[model samples]
Target: MDTTVNGEPRVLATDAAVALIDEIRRDYPDILFHQSGGCCDGSSPMCYPTDDFIVGDHDVKLGEISGVPVYISASQFEAWKHTQLIIDVVAGRGGMFSLDNGREKRFLTRSRMFGGGEACAIPGVQKVV
Candidate 1:
């Protein structure tokens, strides 16, 4: 295993995205993000109140960005396992059920394929699935 502090699994949020999340935090101090793979949002990162949303057994924790925990469904994780998720902010409304809605800007997901060894070395990822 890679023992470097940087080896820890990380989810990145752009400055603009972090700023928006901070603004939303004023009202929802404990918010979480789930990158849905289904339709409607089409892989957009969705943010919700931690108390209001439930992280399912099949979900995987992808570390947090700006104090907000980020999760992805098992099925989605399978497809995204080789990629690093980068959260970004874009103009427009967010998901209807997400906290970013009505904020005039929404969170988006960008990614980069991980280098072979780095992918396996990313801490906090379950090697089994």
Candidate 2:
């Protein structure tokens, strides 16, 4: 599937991320990420938003991970462009690429605790549904 963030296109995952995007696109009418400052693991997982969010410079705009619309920041997007974003199914499913000091960086999420949505674990590598 084609992944685009902030109107830019990039291949984030081999298939897992793409598949998820595809599934969400079909049934989910509203798609976006809940971005914040930090998390226990230095950053939080991207989640389906309950409201509208603005694309910011610090946010990574993920075109489509697993066919789901993901919005990240420009900084995060630039960081993961040339690196392989590893999608670990066990630690939850979706993905976002990041470059930490010129090296490929990856963020994976299964359950997000924001936006009035319950923290639900998602499929390991399946497309969003």
Please, what are the lDDT tens digits per residue for candidate 1 over residues 1-129?
Answer: 121224534466677888898999999888999999979877789999999999999998887787777899988887878677778888999998999999999988877666643543322333210
The TM-score between candidate 2 and the true structure equals 0.40
Q: Which tens-of-lDDT digit does each residue in 14-113 have in candidate 2?
A: 3544444344446555655533335534454444532545566566554455544565456654554543233332233233322111213333533322
TM-scores for every candidate against the unseen true structure: 0.82, 0.40
Q: For residue 7, give model 1's deviation from the true position in Å.
A: 2.1
**Most lDDT-accurate candidate:** 1
Clashes of each: 0, 24
Cα error, residue 15 of model 1, in Å, equals 0.5
